[model samples]
Target: MLTSDTDAYYSPGHVAQVVAQTVERSRLKSVIDSHCGRGALLDAVEKSFPKIHCAGIDLDGNAISHLRKIRPHWTLVRGDSLAWTAWERIHRKLGGSVDVAVLNPPFSMGQVKGVNIELEGRVLRGSLAMAHVITTIYHSNPTRVVAVLPESTMFSEMDRQGRAELERLYDVEVVAQFKSSTFRGARANSLLVGMTRRKRQRAASSVEKAHYMSLHNAIVRGGLPCFEAVSLRHGVPFVHSTDIKDLVRGEAKESLRTVRPFTRGIVNGHMILLPRVGVPNKANIGAWFTEDDVQLSDCVIALQYRSERIAHAAAVNLRRDYEALASLYRGTGARYVTVGRLSEWLTNARNTRTYAQL
Candidate 1:
């Protein structure tokens, strides 16, 4: 049985070697593995940098006992790595110089078995284990930090907030994203990021802005009108994803039929829509908005914006960048834009620059 009690999925030996090789380039005297499961990472670091002192922390007692017996010389401690006491102990034993910290935190949400780790001189909130791990290590003021995190952490609202807090304490150097397959059984993609503490102050205008999150936490509510709700009466205009490009180019024909005044799929002027599904060679990835209220068919997804101005702006910019938007299409023959993935992609798009300028 290839199973372990710790959420500690041991890193493949080759992967551990890669981390060791990457760290070898930097000038460092001490290294800490916040969640060192079975010493997979520590072993590689020791083989490559024989002189560098190492420390390992883990919540699993079995893992700690196993590692301690195998590598008796290491400073292996069994405790919540996010705890202030753990950090203080590690820092003291390493002569107050934690040069580099390698972390592969548990990919979990919520408190770890109701354990609260002290952070920023106080008990940390939230159950996001990755956030806690990074925070604890960063607060220790290591010279360099390398962490493996979920890809959604780059764009998800909650993870973005965690990243924001991290930036307030350090400067991120690289965010290398890799496919989900990089880690076995990983449902989402992951990011191997490197960051260091910010050393100086800068003018407010010179600061690099965080990614615009207009669509990051945007709610995607959709509806498909029933036969009765969609009629040729004096109600609301009916729209489709196929009409989005034409509508943006000001070449769309008037909707032939109208839906009920308060139809289920009816959306106000301040809303965007993409096909719930799209076909190949179809320009269906763009967003659409109009000053007129409209109802959509079941095949469309309606994203309501906070205001009409934002919706119109997003539509225009999305049109100008149609090629990029089209690239979001998924599936083989009957392809479509995935709402969740599209939302993440939109946050990193230049079209959302309006939010950044603000």
Candidate 2:
């Protein structure tokens, strides 16, 4: 039910709350919302802290006009947030640096033509415009930046390259995820992620500290046990989750794949761990590994459960590690479910001809 006609759309109130929290924690002096559709978040900031100087920018002239009527004193600019050249010029004119920048940019979709291709052919792809906007703003020396984005930005392996590039330039500190329903009519789950310049290690450090605190609280309240009881050890290369395909076909050593190395210093017992690679939300996509897969060095193990009996057994056997892993999964929802049953389902489905290939 919640939607915006502006180019920089208005996010849900929860997103505004997260932005407010980030700003308060950073003790920022100035604030700007790059894609400030309708200025809902900017209004929230103004109402809560009247003295803070806030600005809103949007390409839509009508949206800017409406915002000006609502907050006559606040500065609102009409411009494209993604235009790096224009942004650089504006930054120089605005006395160099800003304290915080928040945004909810358009999720553009389209195709491009290239050489060595047919005239009618096109490749499907997600837009990098919004990501580029954030990157550009960060380069402008903003101390803190927060944006509301689709969950795919965090979970999809398809965007790994872009995500890695962004991470290299700016440290992504916290990701507070919410379901699609939380946004009323949004198509995908949304997340409020905070980014800061790598040069400001203090800001990154504080954000990380807050992230752990929030994660711990969610784990404690989500009915999941803490991970302190379960044991974690480095998995063997050959037997790692990635190498499962190789090991199953008799292409690798089975001895190297066992849990021996992981349980070496601690008490010997069975534990549930996930493969280091592959997508995180395997349950939603029904993608997983089987017993016959090859073992790769990137694999790691944690406590797992399928039926209630299995969960109980795993909990009892690896009480410490189970709690630790569960804490990690608390706020993440089904994206972090145990790998045992899901892996079996994925392997079986992959083996079946009727199932569509990923």
Candidate 3:
């Protein structure tokens, strides 16, 4: 079956066989494949769990129609796996949430620089795939869940919220981690994860849930203004990556150049200049603190805070978490991270286990 291709990958028959065996070992009586594609997993599932009742949900009508004909005993529905209504239909058919959920959720979501997915009033931002697994855990309330996800799903800055929530709600166990070429014609690093719901814990209003809930409102974007227009003399003083050589070299910063400010008046307070584009490494990762109200070029990210101590603390925190933050920038090209991801990273670095965690 052709995949949705946005971020979803249809698990091959053999791959599904492996994942199904893992679920079968859990001895679950009922299972739901939230992103079931053409019933590949379901096919292997039938053999793996003969007595278990199975249900599958997918956005593809043809796949659901095809399954209805081929697997008459199975309950298959054509609708979004992310929508509440879709799950409602599945719940009605199954008599309640299933024992376990099998998932091959969408990954990366490369099209959007940032992603936000909310369920049951809790929101997860960053990776669409993480949101899928986390949401399934929330909506299904199943005892166990097994999913095929990107290897970075547990660590990436973009999926931090999902990871945090999962850790909070489940006893996570890694079923398997696969090579980038594990799936034919697919190059993403993948993994199989199994999670069992914890005993009736306190609700999300607990201390940890309050912290996780606070991250949903992390100021991801628009915190720092980008300025590109520049001139030799007339406009406000501006700093570029090249100008920060001495600062990086443990030398005093020289006079900065000038650029047109994006704001109407003088840019106020202490500013932080960060290199937005570069390869991922320690030399490339830094927290360049600046004291000018000057405009900064687009090449560098300019930020401000109400207090100088806060700005200094932020810079120190970013540098402290440099290695983890650098992971956010991946691939062979001149990698870059968006302001939103960076903001989320900084926020996570300080309070929660998302990065630094006291």
Candidate 4:
């Protein structure tokens, strides 16, 4: 059976070769593959740089034992790379010089097992792969770091905090984005990101300042939570995904309701709303607000734009490329779009055209 190693796909020989190629350009003496799986990466590094110090860490005992038997010279330790003890064992051996760090971490594992990250005094529910990247950079302080991560890590609103922290700490850029075909049986896309740690903090990506970056707060869950308690006829106007035929071109036609939310209060000023939970459709995928406020339902997503013009530009952009949004919906059933997917799309869209075009 062609299957991934639970939440992650083990790097194939060819994939390992690509990683080796990336590492070859850098002048480094020691290398570490935090999630080394079957050791394809370390093997490739050793082959390319014969005398380079190599260390591999994995949580799989069988894989580690097998690699140790085959390559007795390597320091293959079986432990979770996210934990400090694993590095301690490696430190006892390699003297803790992590010049180059390469990884293919478990993807989306946090969705099932859950991941809570506390960074700069804010709590984030990001992915496992994201956590791996952040912790690796912090602990190893590697001059060069390369890893395979999902696109959402860089573009998703849910992961914005982690990405900001990483970009804040390193000079990050995408080295390569691999199609699904790159991995034998892997269904999702992945990217090979190369990052160099910065001694001083630098400015973040423009996408970080773009209008869509703030959409994370607007992607609400199904229950509606604190907002659902208010009556539809008493507080603020309520809008559902099915209420509108298509997204409003600029500002929505007035339709008021009385729903009030205790948890998040009310949203006033220019707001752009999208369908948060539904089978993606060009028609039902968009909406917005100006001046007046409404209590958005579970099906709708809300993004507050700094001004009416930016909100109008956003609406125009959505209408122009709404078809692309339809393709982003993912799930076995009841497919839906995420703030990350939309934000990623916005970032790419912004890149393709000039600011004035929007």
Root-mean-square deviation per candidate:
9.1, 14.3, 9.0, 6.1
The residue-level lDDT of candidate 2 at 140 comes to 53
Candidate 2 residue 266 Cα shift, in angstroms, is 36
**Alpha carbon lDDT of each predicted model:** 0.60, 0.46, 0.63, 0.65
Error of 2 at 141 (Å): 2.0
Steric clash count of candidate 4:
6
> Which consecutive 10 residues in model 3 have the weakest lDDT in total?
215-224
The TM-score obtained by model 3 is 0.60
Question: Which model is ahead, 3 or 4, in terms of lDDT?
Answer: 4
Clashing residue pairs for model 4 = 156-340, 234-258, 235-258, 236-257, 236-258, 237-257
Residues 52-123, model 3: lDDT tens digits: 888998887877898899889988888887788888888888876788788887665545544666866666
Clashes of each: 1, 26, 1, 6
lDDT per residue for candidate 1 within 1-358, as digits (tens), equals 0123345556667667767766644456778888898888878888888887789988888999998898888998888765667767776777665777777777755333223344546653333554555655654567667776665454443343355556655666444555556666555556677777667633323332332223323434344444445475676676655656565455543643566654235554445566667742334433455656666666666655555566666656656666776788777777777655665566454534742222
Off by over 4 Å in 4: 1-8, 108-113, 118-124, 202-272, 276-298, 301-318, 321-358
In model 3, the runs with Cα more than 4 Å from the true position are 1-8, 24-26, 108-110, 200-358
**Candidate 2: residue 197 lDDT (0-100):** 63
Best by TM-score: 4
lDDT of 2: 0.46
